[model samples]
Target: GTQSLHTNGMDEALALPTEKAVEIALRTQQIIANESGVADTVDPLGGSYYIESLTDAIEQQASEYLAKIDKLGGALHAVEQGFIQREIQDAAYKTQRAIERNEQIVVGVNQYQTDESIKPELLRVDEQVRIDQMAALQNLRAERDNDMVQAILGRIEQAAHIPNAPLMPLFVEAVEAYATLGEICDTLRGVFGEYVPESWV
Candidate 1:
């Protein structure tokens, strides 16, 4: 699945009743689990000529990349300088071109011509859910001790300002003080200012 499927519209996906979500997940798992001969076999495509050649080529290419990154002072430095992002973009473009030119055949997407419309039941979040969540947040803030929260937040601020200081403890303390995920993220955004990369023009 695309990362967008999980991160971008996931809250709406999860807004289904918990039981329905679990059932859907279980069904998906079962389909994957029961895929023909996958479970009993070790290296299912071991004997396929094309599969072996492609796998070896991919492995060698990855090894070359690892070696290049090591020569360039490792993964973190490469990431900070956008090497990884550029490589990913190049690879994605190459893959897309291959698919478009029929060099690749992706099942049900480009290869299989399925005329059936995919009409799955999409779960919707009601206005009451939003209202209830706001009320819950307000109640939580009202019930929690403000003085302790402020003290913890001060400790968090101190940790953020200090060089090489582990901020996990401050995070734990904030969580213990009943600070919401949104609040923690907002505070970090205030310190870090959000990072937006220059996408390809």
Candidate 2:
């Protein structure tokens, strides 16, 4: 899957991808497909014992982690307990530390030194965009039947508490009734209180 990489505005030190960088990324994929003949092979790294061992190890570890999560009363329980969040935070911290210490060399970041002036145009969302969105939402609410929307929302709230309830059909019905996303989400939030993560500090 081809996708664009986006950099955060907060990371001022990080340089945005230049035209040359974008060309290189696309060209690299083309080289792999044509020159390397990677596309011709069904399983390129299939014969490598190291690769097979690594794959098996990764699968085994993932299965073990899933079993642990199941024992901890599944994914929702892990999230509520901040187990999943902590694991992600720890991994991110480790990766960042590695990059900072030059243990991991990222090209154009820690390695490739370039002073070439590259100013790429960045996309910015204007305040009018938000204003327009709000106006549209307001117009929708004004045109929709408030009584019917409330009734549907109430049914959704009830269905949420009921086990094995086919809530997707109810959600589709709510959408068909012109119920705004905010209204439906707010109803669910009221039913299931917002999760507050445990202090890791």
Model 2 residue 177 distance off true place after TM-score fit, in angstroms: 0.7
Q: Total clashes, candidate 2?
A: 0
lDDT of 1 by residue, 37-84 (tens): 455565666689998888889999999989999988999888777888
TM-score of each candidate structure, all chains considered together: 0.71, 0.73
The 10-residue segment with the lowest total lDDT in model 2: 1-10
Instruction: Please tell me which predicted candidate would have the highest TM-score against the true structure.
Output: 2
Lowest lDDT sum, 10 consecutive residues, model 1, at 1-10
Model 2: pairs clashing at backbone N, Cα or C within 3 Å: none
Off by over 4 Å in 2: 1-37, 115-120
What is candidate 2's lDDT per residue for 123-154, written digit by digit as tens? 44578999999999999999999899999999
